[model samples]
Target: MHLTTRQLFLSHVVLLAGSSASALAAPASKTVSLSYIARLYSMRTSVSGKKVVMKNKWNNIEVETNSRRAWVNGVMVWLHHPCRKAGGGWAIRELDFKKGIDPILRSYAYVPTKKPNMVVLDPGHGGKDPGAVGTRKVYEKKAVLSIANRVKAHLEAKKIPVRMTRTTDVYLTLNQRSDYAAKVGADLFVSIHADSAEASSANGVETFTMTAAGCDSSNYYGQSGDKSTKRGNQYDAANAVLGFSIQSNLVKMSKRSDRGLRRARFAVLKNAPCPAALVECGFLSNPEEEALMIDPNYREAVARGISNGILGYITLVNRARK
Candidate 1:
């Protein structure tokens, strides 16, 4: 976490051209078991007769009815935000089941394409969701919207039709956003967010996909309260792959700290009909990075980084189709 300036610069270079996941898997001095995930299977819970099931393929994590929330390795996740303690249980205000979960059940599944079928751009933290707080008193929502607009403009220049969930500051319900993508038949969905951490030292760019379902039993986060099944795993795996490709490119193009790809049962990613990713541009909590993010030049760079990543995914898909 204590990265020197040179080290940070090196991380950027390697992020763009080196440090493949396999290479980063070099034996470590200490055992880094993922507690966030390991605790899911052991999680205490109460069941509502009502149940929701979710599958995310990126880290092969699946949640069935009565599932407890947890993070997935190789995926980016923020434990405290959106979901916070309510009563004796945890609930994410941004992901209320009524608006978020039900939509996934009714939405269409997206097929992979050489070119994106349609691109759905989500500017994170509309309405009451302030997203991450920054060091210079900057709000995550404002910075992301700037980047999202630029990304939209650039994509449109490429003749790629783009749809924005919220073009202005208006609050749109999570269901409405997801439904919009499904309605438009978008091929890919990208939600823009800025990262913040307790430590200002945590500056970086990362992308996230849906959690994978087939994690080894040992890897289960403590979600003991849930029932499990195979059909869920199949659904999660297919989508996770698409999420992975976008995230991999996102990390590469940004050339920031490799937060590594992550999986979570997020509303936007979970409900979007096509491959979707939520990208954290960088940590606005860091003083230096906060200044950078506020600058128009740096904001443009952030937009370009996201656009490049998407284009890379598009090229990969097109090549595979041949």
Candidate 2:
């Protein structure tokens, strides 16, 4: 689980620059085996429902049975083609196994681009939108705003330039929030929120970045075959890097259920002008987690985790650029 600086779990490859026409047209050149993949990567795997969970010394991942989407470590990734059902097991096409998963896994070797100076922090909800209602009757809007402010304070102490979409309790549409970040020319867009679900046992922290174009979403809300591209698709690599950085630290520092990084078509992230991620700090529906969320120290720790993530991402980008 450790490496030299921003070291990653997978091998490395030089990203080929140019068109993907041949890649798109490439047929399933070979049948790839799941067990082979696990053996090759030195990982162990177990299956539950349609998900296969694999873990190794360096990382863990959950891949779906017949889907190209996989959660690698703390980021959602597209495998380009669906995994095939093979003798009641799962296997992926060699095309995506080589071109899609290989390239992406290699890119995880973190590198820096340039000094990212401006960051835009967005508190998920305000005023009319209470977001999630906790079992303790806590409101998500207030909690996220508090968390965002604490994150800002920590980042400012590091001498990083930071800004907020809203400094006070106010309602801002998703469009407005993203537009404000674009207007300010932010290097990163961080949307903070609390999660809730009918299942009270569902408790954990997860981060989401936009699903790349031409790929199925990780959670699979039936967005398969979505070929239309969006502005946010341009930062797919950066989004994964940033989201993994945040989710990794958050899960480690909070000691909460590791929900893993996810992908979604959030309104605020769909057109984001820069690398963007939406963070679900915790599940308010769970009473225990809600109590932790209400604690100032817990919020500070969460903020510290987020702050560390951004700094890590900045380091990665700056190093990559060099």
Candidate 3:
């Protein structure tokens, strides 16, 4: 009742062809692990069932299976695809590694930053614009101003040279902020705000760099066909370097959820004159995080984390230059 050898061989060939066609129809993804990545870059790593932690002299990464999230240094980053189990351990899609993770790692360790000094800090929403509202009526604009002021103090204290679009409570349009940054010849621009969502359960620290050419933004519906460069497009690599530097520092020290690096085209960032990013420090709607943001001490910690991230980025740039 068994088929002859020739018949069996023909059946196998048909199965192989079908499998190949199925693979071709879907997004291509190859399983990869921390050790594999570490080997490629000569990094030291440790592994557990759910997480892969990699470290070198200058950076760190934490990848978790099925989490759709990873931590590079201290910054929490969202993966394009969740890690999958392979060979009895956690692994990431090859495409995600190459496009999402590798670029960030390389820039952190090697990219030469154009700006050694001159930073423009924009505290998001002021005066008429309260941005997000939280329990106890905590206005996001007020909290952000506090954080931005502290960040400014820290940067200036470090001799990095600082300027803010608005020194006092008043409304500055996104165009005004971007224009002022250009007028002052900024080397970098950082816009800081707290986040809010309809889902109260959502809480975390997320950082956003401008959307790159031919890439969909963090917001899924962002179009991808426009390869033409925009003002912010010129510094895509630098934006990653700067964005991750601050993000890692914040997530590491703030001890809040690491929402991950994201892409957006906010007016301030889209028209920015230099490498720019927007920092969503935490969710204003989450009660626990809301309590923290409202506290002066906790807000200081947030500032410290962001300022340290900026310093870390500066260090990367300076080291690369040398």
Candidate 4:
């Protein structure tokens, strides 16, 4: 199923909206970022005779289609914005593919599945950024990249199309990464990183959503008299849903100390157009955790944990939509 550039771009724009970094102006109003366009292009797949489903982990948007028109269940929901090209094509935006669209389709609505979308993986703190340095002199950028590569390998082995924000030790501005993701129309965005703490005892794994609405800085008590601060805006709520689900799944799989889900207005989450999450695999500042992270075997476990979290969220989202 070969896709034209326009169809590919449209799907990515929708997917990327969930995870794309903020500050991208409307498409027609400003120059579209090339990376954004590239991302949209990267996730494109041929849909002919292939099954396509979409789930908005944030909105519980589920929709499925065989071909031609899309249906929520039996009912047809019109596209918010119809594609002018491809003979007046329609697309389902960042929503759950099967379940989210199920109820609507059950209502006898038109549902169409154009193509299968791809996911985006980002390894944080690369090149000049260097992210957070660990007490062991481990570079956050290099460590995250290693983890990200492992993740890419695992996903590809499953035949799930994947893209990396940076496959090498190159530097990319937050906006550039976000804009590119927006353009790519990624279904989901996962940014990998190693955590650092002021105290070595502060070791654990944490996942983050953009933030919950109306709650900028809620102080949650931690074990060491530390207050957990979660921050974001209303725009981040959906991603927050995705974050919690992913974080929970990660804890269950890795058996790591659950730092729980946090909210930080990081560029990766704040500006993303689609649901996005940043994972602090473990505290590099902690000698035990840092030593483990440096090991190839442990890194594989971390990647497996991350992958499980993502697939778990996807599964839950699909089930909920149903």
Q: Could you give me the TM-score of model 4 versus the true structure? A: 0.59
Identify the candidate with maximal lDDT: 3
CA displacement after TM-score superposition, residue 239 of candidate 4 (Å): 2.0
Error of 3 at 322 (Å): 1.3
For candidate 2, the TM-score is 0.76
Candidate 2 structure quality by residue, lDDT tens digits, 239-269: 7778778887888777787776677778887
lDDT of 4 by residue, 1-322 (tens): 4579889988887877867535233322222221232234242322233333332222222122322233221222222122122223324323222112222222122211212256789899677799877777888899889989988887777777888889999999987777777788876788898888788898777777653322232222122332223322333434544565556566665667876566556777767756688888888888888887788877888888787766655555555555
Q: Estimate each model's TM-score.
A: 0.59, 0.76, 0.76, 0.59
Worst 10 residues of 2 by lDDT: 9-18
Residue 146 in model 4: shift from native, Å?
0.9
Residues forming the 10-long window of minimal summed lDDT in candidate 1? 27-36
Segments of candidate 4 deviating more than 4 angstroms: 1-116, 218-237, 320-322
Write model 1 residue lDDT over 129-181, tens digit each, in one string: 77777757888888899999999998888888899988878777777877888
Q: In model 1, which runs have C-alpha deviations exceeding 4 angstroms?
A: 1-115, 214-249
Error of 2 at 114 (Å): 3.5
- State the lDDT at 31 in candidate 2: 60
Query: Could you give candidate 3's per-residue lDDT for residues 159-178 as a string of tens digits?
Result: 99999998777998889999
Cα lDDT for residue 21, candidate 3 = 60
